[model samples]
Target chain A: MKLKSLAVICLGLLISACAASNDQAASSGSASGASAGSNSGQLSRDVTTTTSSTFAPGSQEELQASIGDRVFFETDRYDLSPEAQAMAGTWADWMKKHQNVQIEIEGHADERGTREYNLALGARRANTVKDYLTSLGVQANRVSTVSYGTERPDALGSNEEAWAKNRRSVAVVR
Target chain B: MARILKILIPLVLILSAFKPAMSQLRVSVEDGLREPLPIAFAPFVTKNGASPNMGRDLADVAIADLESSRLFRAIDPSAFIQTPAAATIAPRFPDWRQINAQALVVGTVGNEPDGRIRVEFRLWDVLGEVQLVGQAYVTQRENWRRISHLVADTVYKWLTGEKGYFDTRIVYVAESGTADRKVKRLAIMDQDGANHSYLTNGRNLVLTPRFSPSRQEITYMSYAGRRPRVRILNVDTNQDETLGPIDGMTFAPRFSPDGDKLLFSAEQRGNSDVFALDLRSRRRERLTDHPAIDTSPSFSPNQREIVFNSDRGGTPQLYVMSADGGNARRISFGGGRYATPVWSPRGDLIAFTKIEGGQFGIGVMRSDGSNEKMLSQSYFEESPTWAPNGRVIMFFRRTPTDRKGRGGRSRLFIVDVAGGEPREIVTPGDASDPAWSPLSP
Candidate 1:
């Protein structure tokens, strides 16, 4: 329908609308850029964009589907809350059941603090989960960690809900 | 000192005619930027006509440099009673004064026999009826921008007795993509955002580019390694190399005052600490060792001390310690968190990012942490870097993304240390983490 209207618009203004043709080219270019940004940005104002493909048991997706594979933290705080603690317990049990599975915990922070400051904070948050899992009998060698700091975010918003979700550590089975 | 700076800045200014050409009758640019002293710039003429339009282009560059500082108002060429021909021949003091121009800049762009461009400019004190400063620079034709900046620096030095920051480069992060998944590359440009070029590709993330004192290399954090660590990019050789063998997620790198050592933060199992490494001897010393997160260490001008940010007190705050890593002391006592403390090149004040109530502000304080003042506030401003002269501060400010997180574009801004409106330094795209280089050697 968009192409049909664009074609009609171009045909109607064929002679005088040099601007129309240029606009068509420019609009198509921007359309792709916008889609790419939104594809990677996932920066919607509304929450609930998190989804995964068909989950196979014992896979990361299955772990995420069975019990959330990530734990959120408070702003600038590394200590886990009751909810995060519970999430870590289940993640520990899953790791214990699958002793062959090795995981890399990726830590992240919201885009509120200085870039370097958040790098340290994210590392701490990832280690907080790493230490928790080790205490819960997850092998230390089985669990590695990397901090993306504020470089990556799960949710891309400036609001409280988005920031809360952004401050998280995700367990990825490698 | 502030009073002296005020006396130096006013374009309506105050350099009383004490003698002849020795003390040129130049004026100050005034205290606040609201009423910048009116200065007129004549369209520079090509003497040999070899380089067509380069004279006008060079004059535009110098004018833009002075105007961006918010200290001088460039009077329109249409308002000039004296034409370029007349300006190049002789300065008609009365003609410039007629247009209410206290200062008039006239120049000629000429080509040398050696295929070099010679840029000459003379700053006339219209109010005092004398020439304030005149300089001639001969360099490669492509270096016309640096020559123009030098012209501006000459005028600025004579007018304010403070060195100009025009002939400098800003090494920063050129960002693309979006919030959740972004690509950052090592990028650089002149202080005025000219000759922009990316030094690194987006294959790996790069951030926090700090220029070496020699102006030939930059130290920054890059994820191209096994983990995030410091990497050195030699500007002249166009080569890249990891910093050291001693590494565990190293980041937040800054060069020492003499450019012989590097200060950076390395994290081991979530415990981060500041360390300094002498580049020549390969000797490394831990500056801050604690359970808390300590990073962003910058050397003092004299290199005898260091100012860094640490959260040892339960919150991120500025701290000072000796260059030898002893006697750590907290300096920031504010309501919110403090980070990125950079010492002024003049060895007086320190610039930092202050986060309070969800708003980020670029602020400065004395080395001892007194006389604190906020320069500019925004949604997300971080990483304050000082100009070569320490008269201005540059930082990156990010606007909040929309509901779809579409437009959280980050840009670089420069604010006068004397307090003025923050002006955006236009770049190719979303830019951040600007590190202002020293004046051209």
Candidate 2:
């Protein structure tokens, strides 16, 4: 069983690497075409103008599209359901378009676990996302991870709805 | 000799008068003989050029500071008959005496010539019909809250014959979010949990924040940038500098008694050992060379010896060692795993968390780890911090909830080290990892 799981993780890594290479090829082609039209002296100034819209534009729309569909797991568990996998694909597609933009994936937990253990669990949750995104061909350096360890909450009520909303790893524009 | 005799005669008379009522006095070992003295806090009178609510605001803050200590029951304003206008203006003793009030606190909040608030108050012993203490302070309008706590501290010291804890602060970990994606931030607040401000942005997990002897700096463990290292943070400047980099995880940090050295545990491979780093020289010394886990090191009052927790003897127990890392001795022989041992500021005892039979408890023992007394028991409890006086301990407790984990709530609590009923301190959200600051000078 352990060997099978390891093989699955390796396959996921290969898929993510292939997808990342295809994205790089598309971006580099556009960069070369743009550079051919502008002289070297003017390229640096126009580069910022081109990359700003290339990276973060339409990010909010893409993030909103995945809202309410994703579900978080208990600490240290990374197996994704059909719904979460669908949401992860949407996030992966969003990253494919905004290749130049770096994002931070933050993981959080409720206040039931011990402090250090919760931190490690939050890290594992973030790493799960990072691994899945990497398998979808996103660059690892472009995605940083942080864990709040049950400190910041999106909802204030102590009900299930609040807990569900809080136990999530969010993709934030860095 | 004649002047001394004159003072001795009234002292003798007062002692004689109290002899008949001595048996009626019920003083618990924890709180001593004095009943929570009932004092009346009449709304301070506001004079010309002062803010309309200044008087009421000062009085309200003063009352809160006094009440938070679980001492001094302030009488309702409706119970007062007359208010004092000046120190020389004697209170109507009969009016207060009729309401069973033993002491009366009267004050005025007015504008001073220098554009500051001048608050003057007098504590009158209604039964004796004499003023026990009187003082005035000039401060900016924004500092009225601090002025109120100072006033309360003065009254507390005068009445109890001990210094007050009102003018202090607390550093703790404020928790939020869900069980899977939670965020913990390093937060500091007034002793009453007011004026709360976060020191870290919840980007990392921070724990065990200890105030320096100067109360200006904090040493805590943080996983910022995913590095489990110890860092020294200056509260005033918001500047943090990482201590010397060690190969493995470093945690369970505390300042030396003189605040010149920091003692903490550094986990290398899987073996954790106690080490001290000099703040000035940036030099490091290994205090315990044992193969067992040694953590939670604290300095004795003179900084010559250190007390810490170790699993060297098969179970986690308290151990003491010299500052130079020699002559180590096991101090705790009790049946439990003890962690987070903190030497009291008074240098008489060490406070720690004891785990026995799957239940956690807060307890204290003598310097040699004898006379262990459990002050509180709960399903989950850790981190026992002492108030400066060492009379009370403030720790975190979590209640067991239902299957949905709905009722599990973590809150800070304080209990007398003498083992009395514990009192819950209310906070907005779940709070934990409490570190009580030394009394502010």
Candidate 3:
């Protein structure tokens, strides 16, 4: 049986469960990512990103043109920036005016990071938008989220400028 | 890691050469990696009027496989004193030894009546003046390439007394189009880059194709129907199924050591956590529930513990916890962010992607987190996958993109852990996220 153990693999679940009492030896920290649990539900003043541009009301094009339905972030951060907070406020106001609109928040990241980590980071960004809008009275059911990780970049280049432009979250109206 | 999924095939042994006890040649795997043995090859000659190129092609492929292992050096055929036919009939040992050859390999290919081909090869210990191996394999003409791999693997195992990875395949993402809107499709090929094919069309995007450890299946994340979900694909049957009856976005998927479960990261609301789902029972269990991102989980070969990449440390780093998430301990203390921690098939080492000082590197460390050594670094590099034997790692490296924001030149590369320059595995276009399958028959 001892030799057979080397060839066959079972989930670590069984061992961890049986060794719960022994686990007290290695207590550790949940640390940094856990600190991100606090949601910034605070919505700032309404400041429309585009005042001159005209948009086709009641259309997906309006989300992109009139209100600038996107927010940007610093590298590896999901919290909405001051500018992103202003953009979120405008988005909440737009959602209130157009009650029929349902939005899918698409989280994206630049190519400077790893695949799985970037994916999780992207999800954090998307969820941050969802949380903000819901806190401002947007129905939770009206919002969905998906993360493209570093797979879909908005900018094509590898420079800092392109990377900055690529790391963003876009609210797609449905 | 070199555990092979062997399809039983009947091979005939024609013991017409010297007895085994007379062959005194023996080489350990350590010697195979360090000091390459010099051997002479006379291309296999054709008999019974088989395709003119079949014999020579077989010899070429087998020699190439042996050379790829970095265990044997093929002395130039131009230096051979005897013709291939003469060597196949009866090797002139004195002539081979005069050229400082430690070993000699010769073979023959012949046509079989039932629309098949027969290949026979002989390995001779030139110093011992004795035959080490002589066997005949009968396979369909189209499967001639596989037969060459079999020959290489057999010789490799017989020489070094270890499993051979020559007969295996690799799956990776074939990238095209612009950097922003790349058409990423899943592509697979032989270990040496032959018989290439695409698994998914570019209509939707796909990423991170991982092979099942026990079956001819793969799991990946696909952005189809406007959602990112974990998907399981049977390579042989072309049957794909969504991983769950449960929701949200799923990515960073990997199969358990036994291939009976899947470990992946899921995002619900705004948090990312690692989860394990039993394939047989459809039971889902959360491995790590810390608010910090816990992703890219992998089981040790023995299933006793799991290693993962997590950002619980503020920056991403490698962590090892009991397989059941009993307790977690950080394993990486290096001055960099670490991601994609893949435990070796041998359970002795772990390979990871390290990002530091504006550079990305591929490195390996002992399972206990000691003796970390970076094998290669580039402008951007990640996704280190281990060969079944755990002696080599395959990853993708991307050069900095151009001014137009166009994607850089990304290609797959392999490096020997024992030490050597990395070699590029060229595909039709840019390729990334390479996963190597166990040795297959």
Candidate 4:
């Protein structure tokens, strides 16, 4: 019985190993991801690339680098800060310039909260950004919102500094 | 030659026909073993061209399972005073008594005519000099581990007077990559961590997998469409569908005792509330209308009531309400915040995860939220699921990563409900969010 179980277990291990390697294959495109390629290659490479030379006057690259395509929020609270409000105003203006392009607003949260709550909090944060943009005259149809909760953190630590950076929402051009 | 063989066959049969008188000693569940019972596990004797080391290997798995319960200490085989000579043979109690073993397990493995393995084992009370129990099981060679679990369960129940949880499985999230960008996939494995397999390809994040009481299905939260939503998957068929275009993010899902309904938290415009949905009719009912986070809803075994975690009182705590969602009452007043409250199958206690003094631990309390006792503590531990018998809990523990959270791994652990050290459950990969399934029919 033990020999039989060992064979089954060995087969299971082999299948899981293959699954892990397949994940590596699928995530290998992330080696050139923005600001996340230094160590364990895991960050999504799904973000669109906008080179400096090919950057339009109001493209994602220019907006992200200058006006900031992201805004931070208080812990467990989705209200925008004064600086965040200013950034949101700039983001609205950029949306106006690129009216033809739609955007997805992703809300995120720190690790201190439960996954479900953080998800709701993230949605609130993303919607807060979207509401500010719509109030500033960007069409509601042009902006969609989703929350990743703490699943995709901008910073990866348990410390206050990392948590602060993680409790924010980013605007991705869709 | 035929006459000579007939004489030799009878001689061999008589030589091996050594069975002790059938006697029984009853052990009661009320007389729980306060200290780990010392037991000797004799290697099974193999015969008829069975794998030479099959008996020893089977014994190893049985010993590991028994020891993991923390109720039985498997005495090292090196100290064994006697060994078995054939299948269906009894152990000499005096030899086991000499080694200070209060209980002993002896077994043998042999190849059958139909290309299968037959395992037979017996449990003996050393001090009382009586046979406690015995059984023989025949199956394909590939099912040895299951045979081992059955053996452990038999031994455990005979000695402890409680149903054992060895023959069960756990579903969890298999995680990979750095902390910032984790790839979480839904995975399932045997309780002892064998036959590990991924249900999802990790294309999307999955969390909080739960098994249905009457179905081979799982309800969990997935970001498959890049949106947080409740999804159900048939583990056997690998088919899945989303539950609701629920106004917003839906998560922390659990199935009702009957498996016909599901309870989960749905957050719309930042207000999270618990809701129930009927599987067949696809009718949705709001269970909690609180403006605060009310998640982790679990149903009692009887399905008469529900226990969930809510932060409506400013801090996360446990609350109980009728299955119909009225007359809600707060039941937790412990020092720390509690979350992920799951009712036990035994219908007496609710298991929960506690956050106190900046550390996370697993604990249990009466169904009415009294007599709370901490079972295990660590840097990060949560998501306690009860074994079918409600005598054990399985959870996941995460190691602290660097200051940047650059590296950390999560693994599953199990502990007896009576409070003992949690032992790690070996898996092929980093794992979390374990849910124990009910005993298979």
lDDT of each: 0.79, 0.67, 0.79, 0.76
- Model 3 over residues B212-307: C-alpha lDDT tens digits? 988878999998887889999887767889976657888889998889999998887768888899989989899998999999999999988999
Off by over 4 Å in 2: A1-174, B1-35, B84-88, B401-407
Clashing pairs for model 3 are A33-B292, A156-B405, A157-B405, B1-B388
* Candidate 1 local lDDT, B1-441, one digit each (tens): 111101111111232333336554444533545677788888788887547689889989999999888878899899887788788778787888898987788888787787776777777777777776666667767667777887888778777778888988888999998677688998888899888778888989898999998748899988885378898888777788886675358899999878999999998888899999888898888888899999999999999999999999999999999998899999998679999999999999999999998899999999999999999998999899999998899999999986578889799999988898899999989999999988876
What lDDT does candidate 4 reach at residue A15? 45
DockQ of each candidate relative to the true complex = 0.34, 0.05, 0.34, 0.24
Range of the 10 consecutive residues with the lowest summed lDDT in candidate 1 chain B: B1-10
What's the DockQ of model 4?
Answer: 0.24
Higher-scoring candidate on DockQ, 1 or 2: 1
Q: Which of the predicted structures, 3 or 4, would earn the higher DockQ when compared with the native?
A: 3
Quality class of the docking in candidate 4, CAPRI style: acceptable
TM-score of each: 0.86, 0.68, 0.88, 0.84
- Can you give the lDDT of residue B348 in candidate 4? 93
Local accuracy of candidate 2 as per-residue lDDT tens digits, B1-441: 111101111110111122222222121335622456688877787885898788888888888877656667888877666654542256888888888887778877788787877777877677776666667777667667777877887777766666677767788888776543457788887777777778888878778788887648889988886667789988876779888767656777888877889998776533568899988899999988886667788898888889887767866678998888888898887886677788888889998887787678888899887899888988878788888777778999977645444555889998877656778876768888888777665
Check candidate 4 and list the clashing pairs.
none
| Model 1: how far residue A37 lies from native, Å | 39
